[model samples]
Target: MKLHELHINDFKFFSQVEGDSPLLKIDGNHLLVYGENGSGKSTIYWALYTLLECSFKKSDDEVRKYFKKTGDESLVNIHATGTNNTYVKTILKDALGNPKTYRVSRKSSDMSIRANTDIRESNMASDFINYRVLFKLHSSKHSNKNNLWNWFLEEVFPYVKKSSDPCLIEFEALKEGPTKFLDLNGNQLFPTASLQDAPSDEEKIFYRNYRDYKQKWVTWHFWLETFLTNITTRANDLINHDFKYNFKIGLNIIKKFPTFQATDDKIKWTDPEIIISITEYEGIQNPAIKKPHTFLNEAKWSAIGLSLRFAILETRLYTADLKILVIDDMILSLDMCNRDVLLDIILNNYVNDYQIILLTHDRFFYELAKSKIAQNGIANWKYLEMFEDSSGTFPKPLIIEKTNQISKVWQLYHGKEFSMAANCLRKATEKLCNAYLSRQERINVNYSVKNLHEMLEAFRTKGMANGLNQNNLIKLIEYKNRILNPSSHYDIETPLFETELKRAIETIEALSIEANINV
Candidate 1:
């Protein structure tokens, strides 16, 4: 699943962030939410977790204090924010390119739970006061769990209902059955809250229609055993359906696979060096294997994180119906080769399947994403910039791009050695340099959005042969204003922008590949 856009209000540091946009335009399978440790980048992540009711193993109490009760008193209330009555609306694109929205809002004080009032919304509102509004929600937002479950069973995948299909199915195979989720359902599926009573008319219209209520959600687990093979996982006896907990393999193998026992309350994947490849658990270990999610040892650190995250983002953005991705600088840990390899994976594998949202403190990561899409003539991707100013109410995210240095640099970074991207940038640098060399010959009066817009427009009047297509040229020029001004999802009636973006990316990538660049 991928997130196209998110709107958060009255939640922690984000007092009323409605127009926040991502830093780059993406139509791939992965989404990354990049930020420094204290930038509230994860807040966007938590908002989704809260709405979906999924429990992240990492959140601590300090993060919880920022989510609770302070706002509205109405029948239908979301977690009450300390900031005025708040609203959070998340836009998602599904597997088939359909879009839907989910929103949670709370009224300001003197709460109510009358017959005319909806208790569920009130409870959600009450949860606001309790602290940290977590979701564990129906598969999607905007609606209730029951309806969602029904649709999943009747439409998306009915097999998810049985313990064998909807639940993670494991067989008693092998001399030592390594725990495996075959029929394979794990992260792909999850559980929801058991509601007590149906809500009032208004609530029923929204909440009752939710599919997560009576139904279950499922997906395959992420990690695999690298050090040990021919292993076995236990049965569903110890698994928790609602929260989607997995068997703690490292501890289970060491302590209790044969009646596995654990030595610690907290558990995590054991291999520190093992990289994850979402394409498959069985084939990735071999270097000869070819899959969408192949384990890779080579990538450029300056660009790898962006590549890996974007690969999945591009997939979801262009293909899936529900698009929401939350990444916390997952690529910050790699080197340059790994980064380049990662970018190739994204452009080649994930873009046709999802929508992506990402964050990064690294300018390198941002530039790499843009460069890959833009140089290839991709128009679907957009760049979002984040900053904090005391003069503002809270931290804000802005969408900005031009000459698209960020995108251009990102493209230059692919397959780039330590300073290769920086080196290639000399050509663009020469554009600036030659201008300086000839500054004495003739000149312009000033530098600003006004003059910049005028120049791009004048260039557009001359047409495609001079620079870009009409639409592409216009989008490039209007990019910054669109991000700063804010627009509704209603405005973009088609993922066509995203689709066109992906095809452009593919087109450019083909260029590199045709010339033997190994994209």
Candidate 2:
């Protein structure tokens, strides 16, 4: 399903974002949201989570616990006045182009949810990903009791529970054998009667059944090991796909691909407990007597864990006609190179099919993604800025214009804000250089001053190779040296005035047009 809009009212930092139409309209099933810390980015994430709960018929208590808050009062806006109910209403479109609205609301102490018009349950929760869920999976503190692994397995391979193994049949029979002949006192009277001396015909029959039960018990023990072994194989197959993908893309950081296995050889027939052991290639090759956790660094482990989650989601949700993928600051642990690869994977592989809502606090990553998405021909993708105010938090759409930065620089310079205008001019230059480099598919430049120079050189080389006017190149280099470089460093003593700043801005603007990098 595609989310057309979401209306959040008094749920968290957002007090009321109302509209005659949808408040947060999604144009092309792709949204890139940028917000600083505590800017209610996570509020939007959880608001969507709440809406998903409503769709899935999750209980109020469960939702409250998930939010880690007590009572409906904690969920309401702290600034809310009397009788203003807090709610999150989500509007989505199904594969048939039918509109569906789901709303979750909270009052003083009451919570209620209204699902699709028919109030049908949904199983779409598996499509959502947030930091908390990922961190739990990546955390090394978890043991065999981790519920995240269990949920992952169930969601990714729901058909596993339907396996009709003969061993499972025998195990079930062994469990129900005693209960099939329980007496009024809840005792296995048949087994007890079998031990009596002068046993009657009924006692003889009980003895025979008891012997059969004992034989089945022994058989179940033997088969249980085989059942667990089969399950282990399936789990490895699923995890190995993720491991290979992660290791392949994260090769710069991780030297070798890791292997994962269940920690225990035997598993319970019901509610099996599983803990994973990640063995590094070196450890496996060298046959080390070390613990699994000692084999990799934190970053590598995080990559493996996060990639496993993505692999599970991709394997399961790739076939769904309508899917929403919510990613919240999941690339923090990844390096720049891997981040680019991850973005490429998302856009090329998933963006066309799924509605992806990505949230990030990193402005560099946000800008990089904006450029990448635009380059991928996703014209209608919306970029939003989330920030807090005295009243509450709000989301403002960031319009992408060809000359947005240069125009701002001109405005500021005309308004006599020379310092700020010079800064804007420097930023515009950096953006222009990056945009040009990106157009040429040179996306490996890191977000650093040194790399910015490399971008400038690369852009200049490409422009000149394309027969760009030498005068424009000279003007670009002059602006970079006199304005951009000095403005970026306080230690540099390059004089800046209104005339020079205006000339710098004009030079960059002209070069932007001449190089065909305006967009």
Candidate 3:
């Protein structure tokens, strides 16, 4: 299963009344999005993130508050009159190709979303990584240890299963604690304020709940120790193999250590700490590096941070049906070489295992990634560009769906640039010819030597034997000579040039049909 579509209304840079935003169609393909800074690309990131997180929230307001008009973090367009229709909706495709729709809105109830099994699994399966998430790993001072306690509590703990019951999550069990607890049959055993005035039977129940909660804490602590150790090994493996780094990440998760205050009527615990240390630097083993943030450069810090996150996600769940990997400008600190290595790791390792949504603001990186995707022949990837349109009262996101070669032909042609259109058409024809020949010859056809004239002649020869019509071949050759040839340039002001260019387009379409190809 994977995401099919994402729709947003009156959410941040997307406003329905502004007439700029379009329905973002994932179409179950991996997406590569490029948006400049202030272009509202991150809006897309937050929309998906917020929607999936709503399933786990205790109250609908926790999700709806973001879309409300009053909050500082409100995602609604500031120029909007109200938040009545502000929402984020996602359509996911199940294994059998059926779409399951889920929505979060200000006026709606989240009861159904909380009860959804697929959504719950999706929330657990997916991981959202950005520059901020990476920086959090080593954001602490060198004088102090890098503690990821709150990070794990908010991000990782919710997905981890309890040892005693795999169906129960650690976050849910830890949040309520012993007091104000619920029975297995969904009954509250005692009041939340205080159990002081409770009956003797209820008091016994509270004590039992406390004991069980303590046992759970102990079990979770043990599991976490093992989990950290295991993830450390995995992180080192990635650092060695993928990042090609010398140092290894040393992780120690300090247990919360449950405590009790009898008069408070609630269980209390210490704050857990995930201490990140560096070891084995530059062929030296067991280096006592207390402050990795201060010792290591930003590039090395990024490598360690990324590797740890990747390893943790891998250890959490090996695979899931609807896993999504959304990365937003995660390689900002890395140099060109490291950036390429990271891209390779993502493409070669995670591409097949997850539906990837790669967002970047760097045009060079975007083009580089697009070229790599083409070179690797990844067929089911979509490219999109986001721009900010500031013609209105507020900036709105302008989404443009980027397409392949022949689409560029139409783009240039529609822009009334006939010569450039002709050049693109020639390239498109060359690509189409190469595609047909490669399939027929059962070998990779080199594009550098396959000129337009030679390819047309070759196509006429081979395509005729495979049922291409003689008149269509002749017409394609005539159109190619008349318009597509680079030497036969004409002024854009001439009527004949535009007419012949249109004829060239029609001829390309006919050639494609006759050759049974799509350029």
lDDT of each: 0.34, 0.55, 0.73
lDDT by residue for model 1 over 401-469, one digit each (tens)? 333332453442332211322332333323322332234322255532223334334434543454434
**Model 2 TM-score on a 0 to 1 scale:** 0.56
**Cα RMSD to the true fold for all candidates:** 20.3, 11.3, 8.5
- Per-residue error for 370 in candidate 1, Å, reads 1.7
For model 3, state the Cα shift of residue 306 in Å. Answer: 0.4
Please write out the lDDT profile of model 2 over residues 1-519, one tens digit for every residue: 667877777667666445434557674357888777776777777777566545433356554443333455366656666356567777778757788666666432324453342322233423566655445544544443323334434332331222222123344455544323443345444353333343455444455555666576655444433433454444344334433322221110111111211222222234333334433353243244233434455555555555555554544432332366778887776677556766776787677667788898888999999899878777557777654332214332222222377876775555454565677677887778767765444555453344556677777788888887777777777666666765454532244555677677877888888877762
TM-score per candidate: 0.38, 0.56, 0.70
Query: Sort by lDDT, best first: what order?
Result: 3, 2, 1
> What's the distance in Å from true for residue 247, model 3?
2.3
- Show model 1 residue runs off by greater than 4 Å: 1-4, 17-42, 53-66, 69-83, 92-99, 105-320, 375-379, 393-519
Give the candidate number with the greatest lDDT. 3
Show model 2 residue runs off by greater than 4 Å: 19-21, 58-73, 94-98, 107-122, 141-272, 278-290, 315-322, 390-519
- How much lDDT does candidate 1 score? 0.34
Tell me how many clashing residue pairs each candidate has. 118, 1, 0
Task: Give the lDDT of residue 466 in candidate 2.
Answer: 81
**Model 3: how far residue 197 lies from native, Å:** 22
